[model samples]
Target: MDATKMAAVGLSASYGRGPAITDINLEFGPNSATAIIGPSGCGKSTFIRCLNRMHETAPRATVTGKVFLDGEDIYEQDPTAVRRRIGMVFQRPNPFATMTIFDNVAAALRFNGRHSREETDKIVYESLQAAALWEEVKDHLFAGATSLSGGQQQRLCIARALAAQPEVLLMDEPCSALDPISTAKVEDLIFTLKRTYTVIIVTHNMQQAARVADRTAFFYLGKLIEVNDTKEIFERPKEKLTEGYVSGRFG
Candidate 1:
């Protein structure tokens, strides 16, 4: 599948008071993985939220500039549709407490008004396979989502996101809370995800960024400092601020 093209032009966002991101501009290509890295409160999460129009969901939040998906401004389109096409997986695994594993992935299908049992089953199975969870959960399709381990639950969330067939996946610290093994699994899944979906990840772990991202964008104080290939960003950053942060001089 050809990757979807997306860009944010002169984007700035505020929470009814101060700007969280300022005059930010960036472009993303299909089937590419870009990592947004910075310290806490540097707007890494906020920027990705704006990409899919989720930032506006906050109370009294305000946004300026345009986010384009396939050359059309997303802010001018239905927010729900924008989100479905650009799915987000959060830092924590937040599976539906009451739903079974199958139901969790199926929820997305149901929301889109797809009701055929045969098709739903097929989609659910395929999505689980895509998420790299089918082998682990195939026998327990009806198990409660909460019954899974932290890692399994996170993959389940990824499966849920995949069921919608999003062209882009915005993962905000998706593995921060998991153990090393689980984190590795999610990282591997990310590499596979970018083969067909555009991936934008916000992570404080620079090493993780290097492992998964094709290109890395560095942000500081709500502004983009430098962006380049992951190796260049770490070995030869052009901006002093980026150099300091990546070199462990300051975070």
Candidate 2:
């Protein structure tokens, strides 16, 4: 599949009364990974939620400015279509407890539209493989999704997103609840997945950002402080705020 480019122009979002992120401008290239990092409540999650219109789902939530997918304004498109094209995995691994692994992966495609059982199965298999969870679960596709370990469950969520065939994938702190081993596995998966999908991840782990992202963006108090190649952002940040935060001086 061809990769997609995403651009944010003067983008801002607010929940009810106050702004979470303001006047954010950034561009993400196709087939690459960009990590958004900051302290808690820094609006990194809110910024990614706006990329696919997920922010609007919150009651009284509002957004200003524009987010573009391949030069087209995302806000001008159908929300459902936008979501289908730009998929998200949350901070927690949330596989439906009632559904089997196969069904969990197939749910996205089935919800989008009708598909032959054969086609659904094919996609389910491919997505699991893409997520690096197939070999572990192929023999028990019918097993409940929650029966798997946390790491496996998170990969299942990733597979669910892949089943949508999204051009861009947004992950909001996907490793926060995972163990070191599980986190490493997901980090490896991120490296592989970026070969086809444009990946934007929100993470608090700066070392993880350095490991997975080609570029890094730092946000603080809802404002973008700096953006650059991961090495430069960590090794030679231009902004004192960024340097201080990265050096453990302050959040």
Candidate 3:
């Protein structure tokens, strides 16, 4: 879990022939929190999606450049296997409406080829505990996932991702839809989770980035403007664009 262990090389992505982001080179150290901050449509979300190959799910989306997972090229191998090692959580809680809480967490394991009931159960419990949802729903594992509060549902979504025991976790504006209290809880959870999983988050909230990220990368007009330690990015940015945005001059 050393913060300097994992790194990513040059990465670029586009939709059809139109480039959304380009010349993006960065590294996400193991067990560290890296935040991508930008205004809406600045390609922060697109960047994270490309990390796990979810960009391919969008029609006409195409990605180029290499994404190295512990020095191996993820883009050169089977995307499914890459995704098994890098999980994602979206802006909204997207638990399957028809499945129960326990089943939602277990589905990823089952799909990844864990067929034993005992193994699935163990993974489900461990994932839920990791996501900080086990104490609330351990007795109601069969309850519909949607029945939980917005905060709980978001945590369940996180649990579902963790069930696969991924080495990296990608979160896209994960607290955007929640109340302040719920957002605080998710923020706290992100801090706790970074001890075991390298986390890359795309967030519009500058304060959130300043609060949680060890390192911060700023995006402007689909290009990376600056990347440095969070404190420097917030307090003494090297780029005028970064200072302007952080100082509320412009996005």
Candidate 4:
């Protein structure tokens, strides 16, 4: 594989006693998008959350494995630093309610370090542009974040994450809450984003996975059943489990 931006080796995560995901070994290449697809409770979300140490935020959660970023063990680094390098977007839109659209993105830049107003402004604008929300809200940058529609709010959250200059973006069912039109917009943005960032998205929408991902991984009962080219996985899965899931015979 071309130099991977991130990899997980013998990774497992759990809440207290029972493991949610077990021994996941995967690699994500630079500048490509990978979709994790499985039925609900299949550990798709749990696996990605462990990627950036977000899994530890849960009560009594434990992780035992190695996650490497560019050949460096991320578990040995500061959790905050690891998260900054691997930003995430949740299933629902979660822009800060009190901050304006510009401020929401600016908050990420400010949190990373001190920047002059001009520098912050430039980054905020560019981030918004990257999320494809600039033209819609440029004139009202100071408007409250909650004022935007559901789709706009989700894109704003994406812009906020981008403002942090992350190398990888993890999206857990990012469009599950949006209408079809909004979902299409986010899909377009995903296409644009994979050109620069290594993107990993966990989605239950098989069609969405087929549309947006270069590769797709299927998980079943907390285990990764198969990982392969999107076309191959959908059309000709190597494993029987993968074939059954892709063919809608079982989840």
Candidate 5:
């Protein structure tokens, strides 16, 4: 599948009364990873949600400005198509409790409705392998998804997203609820996935951002404070605010 570059222009979002993020502009290249780093309620989550049209799904939420996927405006495209091309994983592992591990991955392919049973099986296997989960779950494909540990569940969710063959993947604090070992596994998976998929991850863990992201964007109350290469962002940030936040002086 072809990877997609994403850009936001004059972007802003609001929950009816006040804006969550305002006039933010950023560009992400294909097959790269960019981390969105900020404190709680800094609009990091809202901003990533807008990338794939998830923000507008919230009640009373509205977005202004444009998000472009490979130069085409996402807002002007069909919402279902936009979402299909961009897949999301939430903060918590959210496997369908009733579905088997294989079914969970197959469900995404089924929803797209173009693949035959043979093709679906192939995709599911490949996705699980891509997520580095195949070795652990291959023996229990038909078992309940919730039977896996928290980390395994998260990896299964990633495999499900991969099964869609999305051009872009959006992850919102995907490792926040996992143990240190689980978090490290996910981090390694992120590093590997960027070789083929453009990934945007919203995370509160600064070190995780440093470990996984090639580029880093720092957000503050409703605005983007700074963005730069990961090394520069951590070592020699141009903005004092960015320095303060990264240095643990203040958030």
Candidate 6:
């Protein structure tokens, strides 16, 4: 197995004193893919956000326990710096409608103090290519990002995340808004991406999780019920709850 890139030790989180998830422990390996799978409202998204310190963005949201990146406590460090190294992509394509595609991809690099225009341009193009969007949008770099299709917009958001060159990428249902074909494209991208960056995705689609993840974790009512290799989780789950959920008996 690859070295651990991220780990949660007894992680617990809540909204306004109401616990959303508790005692969650998991480790994500470098250059590997892990998927958090469960029904809606199972705290899967909350868990991923906690990994990158984004859980604090919500009013009244609080997190306890430890999140370690390369064995360093992330919460003890600067949240801004943690986010820069652990990028995220949301369920919808959140491109800035007012900005052009090029600007959208360049925003993070600029914010992080990449001042040279030549370097910014090079990073933007390279990141887009890494996200598999460059060939399609290369000629329209300055077009309004919103002018693209939903699939293209999602890919653009991915490119924007990649621009930061994060060591770990946390995605919350990244392909939820895309069509089947677009979802397939993103799935392929995720598979290929594990060769370069660790990926943890929260997905409700069982087939999607099975298709792209090396490991799958099942959460229920704020508790992780089981976690194991994808084949074991889907084909021969160890726990009754895991088997029921994966076999479509119940969510």
Question: Which scores better on lDDT, 2 or 5?
Answer: 2
Best-matching candidate per lDDT = 2
Tell me the TM-score of each prediction against the true structure. 0.97, 0.97, 0.96, 0.98, 0.97, 0.98
What local lDDT does model 1 show for residue 152?
Answer: 95
Off by over 4 Å in 5: 1-4
The backbone clash count of each candidate, in order, is: 0, 0, 0, 0, 0, 0
Model 4 spans with C-alpha error above 4 angstroms: none
Ranking by lDDT: 2, 4, 5, 1, 6, 3
For model 2, the run of ten residues with the poorest summed lDDT = 1-10
- What's the CA RMSD for each of the models? 1.7, 1.9, 1.5, 0.8, 2.0, 0.9
List pairs with backbone clashes in candidate 2. none
lDDT of predicted model 2: 0.95
- Please list all clashing residue pairs in model 3, or write none if there are none: none
Q: Which stretches of candidate 6 lie over 4 Å from their true place?
A: none
Model 2 per-residue lDDT tens digits across residues 76-95: 99999999999999999999
Q: Which regions of candidate 3 fall more than 4 Å away from where they truly are?
A: 1-6
In candidate 6, position 95 carries an lDDT of 94
lDDT on C-alpha atoms for all candidate structures: 0.93, 0.95, 0.89, 0.94, 0.94, 0.93
Clashing pairs in 5: none
Candidate 2's error at 62, in angstroms?
0.6
* Alpha carbon lDDT at 76, candidate 1: 97
Query: Alpha carbon lDDT of residue 249, candidate 6?
Result: 90
